[model samples]
Target: MAYLIGILITIIILLLGYIGVIEMQIRSMSEQLERRLKAHTRQNISVQLVSKNLNQLVICINKCLKAEENLRLKSMQEEKQFKEMIANISHDLRTPLTAIQGYQQLLEKGELSEEQRKRLAVARKHSEELKGLIDHFFEYAYLLNTQPEIKLKRINLTGLVTDCLIASITSFEEANKPLEFEETAPVYVEADEEMVTRIVQNLIRNSVEHSEGTIKVEVLSNKEGILRFINPVREPEKIDIQRLFERFYSGDEARSRMGGLGLSIVKLLAEQMKGNVTAEIKGDLLEIKVTLPLAQ
Candidate 1:
């Protein structure tokens, strides 16, 4: 009886030791997986112990990792190809557009009947609009392909917005949209000057082009500098607020010419400057807000 009891005790001890070894191996594998994922490495999780079950688990995990890595590489390649295609298309369109504009300028210099002059004026206007569209596409592609050099500095938000509005006054008048803005106290933010200027200009242009009624602008400062643009739209229900910043997503046929690249550019530039942009519909009004870090 004593010998039998001793053997039973030894078997229990061995069983517990086996379980402990399996637990440690699992923990090591967990750590290896974490390291591999964080470092984005091609290294596979390896096992130290000789267990069939654990080896199978490692194999499955390695297979999953390989699949994920392949998907990531494929996505990156596709995006590069898409950007290159856009750049090429924009470049190709610009050459012919430039020649057309040059010919239009020559036509403008020559004499013409009243009706011909009117038709020429209309052609010039549409050609200018087409040129603007092409330029937006080219700029969008350039922005995606290269990282812009940002020079961060303290900027007067109120003054910058005011300047942009003043510069865009003629456009607003031409669109017959009344502009409304109440001057507030000076607000300051830390951002890239050129980027912020572009953001403001793009927002203003968007409002001028799309607003059905009055266009309003406001600037406020708290923890961050807030620049807000409010405008009335004819059909708020048709606007997809969520996809407003998506590349090439236009909410309406009128906006199709630019392909929604203007707001997309604004969003990208704002994010690059450690800022953010949001849009929402308030009743009949569409409000777009841009927030940037306040100056210290």
Candidate 2:
């Protein structure tokens, strides 16, 4: 009986040891799985920094993929819409051009009175306006499709502002809008020359077209490089300030048909040049501030 009890005790000891070994193996496998998962996350694109992060990482990635598919679909729809818009615009333009040609033929063949010639000139001017509208449409479309390449250089901000002002005079005159610029020292910063110029010009035009009161452009040296565009609002603006960079967004309902690529293109170019854009309202003034990193 003592031998039997001893054999039983031996068997119990062996069972405990076997159990311990199994548990250890399980623990090692768990640690290995964790390590591999972390490594895989580091290599993958879909991983997001969530605190409950591991579990949700896969979910976030899936969501991102879904969102990307949606965006591609949306872009496809926009392409189709643009094609229709172009066809309609082309048809509208041809009507005016045809009228101008008919009038020109009549003027050339007959002794038209002064009044008739004047009316023909007016018709020609309206036809030119139609052409101008088409040209503007093409400009926006081109800017939308073009990829920006930033060429960094040290530029004089004040001088750039001066040049932009000079270019805008004629544009403002045609729009029956007055433009004013406030200046400061020649602040130097690193940016793409062409892009900066375009940004300033667009902002100026947008402000002029949308503002009810006088427009003010102030170039001040702030942290790095800052350009501020300010204008007094006549009508309260309904636009979400956060959405100012969206394409075809305009504050005034009446001006919506002017159909601009101005702010949208400016935003894109600014980002490509490693700059930032933001807008705000102070009292009756609508202010847009753009900041760029200074040249080392």
Candidate 3:
């Protein structure tokens, strides 16, 4: 009986050692799988193990990893196809749109009766609006499908916002919207100059289009680059600030047909630069803040 007990103890010890080895292998495989996934590799994941249960667990994990890899490949293919389609459509439309605008200009230059001139001006106006919508569509498609390499440099946020506001003064006057910009100390950030310009232009344009009162842009130089745009909402209660950054999201159903890519693009660009953007509606005041890492 003593000999039988000794044999059982030995078997138990061997089993525990086997399990410990299996556990260590599993941990190492898990780490390797994570590294491969992070590097976006196509290597098959498999780990040898002694215990039956552990072998089964590795099998399940490998199946999941394979499925994930397949899905990733499929998504990448679809994205490439979609980007190509957008480029082709944009080029096809731009060629004819440019021709139409050119002819419209020539027509405006030619002699015409007062009624004829008014009709031509109306036609030109609609054409210009169509052009703007197409441009937005192109931009949205590009921003949504692909991540472009941005040239990051130390840029002055205050001066950039000021420049955008100054350039938009004429439009503000035309829209009868009072524009105010409070200049603070120069807030510099490491960001793509062109992206910063686009973000500012889009935010200001969004505010100008939606605001009921004055549009105010301010720069706050803090640990993070804080560029704020303040505007009074026409119906603060109805606006969903959370949905403002969603692609093709509009405040109202009436404006749904209007291309709503401006703020969405801003959010994407901000995130690509490792920055953040948010909107808050307090009573009637709408504040949109864009924060980026401040350059030392």
Candidate 4:
């Protein structure tokens, strides 16, 4: 009876020993599998387990590895296709659009009656709008498909905002619109100057087109660095705040006149610079806010 008890105890010890060895092997395999997946290597995780339970775990892990590999391959293929489509749109479409603009300019130079000249001017206007639309499409496509190189530096927020506002003032003046800028203390942020310039330009363009009354630009130093554009609109209900930043989303008939890439580009560029943008509508006021990380 004692001998049989000893034999049973030895079998139990061996069984526990086998489980410990299997656990160690599984831990090592898991670490190796993680490294391979992170390196994006085309390698399957394999394990040799004598026990049934461990073998089942190995099978589950292998299935996950296969699924991960398939997802990675599919993402690569989709990205490649997107780039090719953008290339085709840029080359094939823009070339002819450029030619059309050139001919339109040449036609403007020729002599014509007053009515004909006015009609030609309208044609020229629409042509210019079309050109802008095409450019917007190209820019949106590029921003979507590729990561733009951003040169980060300490930018003077007050100075940058002032310059962008000044550049846009002429357009507002020509439209017989009153534009206001409330000066703020100089604040700095880490940002790419060119990209920030684009962000400001797009925001101002949207205001020039849609804003009705006083257009105000201000820089606020708060929890985050904020550049705000406040403008008065005729009716606030016409604007869809939620969909304003979405690509090709024009909330109203007036906004539909635009190519609808302005706000989308602003959002993309802002995020790349470690910033974000938001819009608020209160009463007839439409305020667009761009917030950036303050320079440390």
Model 2, stretches more than 4 Å misplaced? 1-136, 173-176
Question: What is the full ranking by TM-score, best candidate first?
Answer: 1, 3, 4, 2
210-250: candidate 4 lDDT, tens digit per residue: 88888888898887789999998867897889998987788
Q: How would you encode candidate 2's per-residue C-alpha lDDT over 1-296 as one tens digit per residue?
A: 99999999999999998667656654654565476566643232332223354436555655665686679789999987885675567556767677777867777578888898888888776566556456555555555556556689999988998888887788778766667776677888899888898788778777877877667787777677988888777655576688777766776654465554567767777887888889898877888888888877
lDDT score, candidate 3, position 285: 95
The list of candidate 4 runs beyond 4 A from truth reads: 1-61, 141-149, 232-243, 254-257, 280-285
- Record all residue pairs in model 3 with backbone atoms less than 3 Å apart, i.e. clashing: none
Number of backbone collisions per candidate:
0, 0, 0, 0
**Model 3 C-alpha lDDT per residue in residues 1-296, reported as the tens digit of each score:** 99999999999999999878877897888788888879977676667766677678877877888898789889999978877886677668888999999998998899999999999989997788668667866887788677799898899988988998899998888878998877887899999999999999888778877778888888997789999999888777887887888866888643355467778888988998999999998889999999998987
Residue pairs clashing, model 2: none
Q: For model 4, what is the error of residue 280's alpha carbon versus the real structure, in angstroms, after optimal superposition?
A: 4.1
Candidate 1 has a TM-score of: 0.92
Error of 4 at 19 (Å): 9.8
What TM-score do all the candidates reach, one by one? Answer: 0.92, 0.62, 0.82, 0.74
CA lDDT of each prediction against the hidden true structure: 0.92, 0.72, 0.84, 0.84
Error of model 1, residue 198, in angstroms: 0.7
Error (Å) of candidate 2 at residue 121 is 6.7
Q: Any idea what lDDT model 2 has?
A: 0.72
The TM-score between candidate 4 and the true structure equals 0.74
